[model samples]
Target: MARIQTEHGGRNVQVDEYKGKKIEVATGYDARSDRWPVHVYIDGQKVSGQASADNMSEAFDYGFALAQREIEQQ
Candidate 1:
């Protein structure tokens, strides 16, 4: 898998390509909520249903899986 790091909305984003599709995972920590927010984008389009996790790694996992599922559905 090819991976790259970029920034989106002032947050660091990790991007991977799968099956010729670009999957971007952006994670951020919300101090007030005490949770990590994860956003997944496929081919530059944001996927629905945002997810949150207790840590960064888990957040990324959720985002990656969400992106993969989106690509599979398409």
Candidate 2:
């Protein structure tokens, strides 16, 4: 398992790789917000992209999709 620890929206968020894949197994949040921020990384390189929404679930869904797209592109 691999993990990337980064801060977003003043909150600490960690994206962990599961089964040795680029897909983030889980997203962590330590702050309160209707929207959650995501820190994306591809092949150990951090990707510059902002994904957020008023809904935390939607935000995470978008982030996960973005991550998957990035991984496929690489």
Candidate 3:
């Protein structure tokens, strides 16, 4: 449970751990509504994709699965 400072400033972003790897989750915002519109960041990359459900937990699962698949493939 730690945050790595990004160029985006000093926001305390959470980094999750999976299989000893670090994963980060971020949300997309609806500028007009100021609401997070279904998005997740994995290791600072947009990996949950655009068509994913608007759920944080689901996003986390997707991130973990994607990372695991890539690791196994390599």
What's the distance in Å from true for residue 28, model 3? Answer: 3.9
For candidate 2, write residues 34-53 as lDDT tens digits: 45566555556676866556
- Tens digit of lDDT per residue, candidate 3, span 1-74? 34442323222233566556566644443456544433345455665345343444454455456655654664
What value does the lDDT take at residue 36 in candidate 1? 87
User: Global lDDT of each model?
Assistant: 0.83, 0.56, 0.47
Q: Which residue pairs show backbone clashes in model 1?
A: none
Write down the worst ten-residue block by lDDT for model 3.
Answer: 5-14
Clashing pairs in 3: none
Candidate numbers sorted by TM-score from highest down: 1, 2, 3
Model 1 quality (TM-score): 0.86
Superposed by TM-score, candidate 1 places the C-alpha of residue 49 at a distance from the truth, in angstroms, of: 0.9
- Each candidate's TM vs. the true structure? 0.86, 0.49, 0.42
Better of 1 and 3 by TM-score: 1
Q: In terms of lDDT, which candidate is strongest?
A: 1
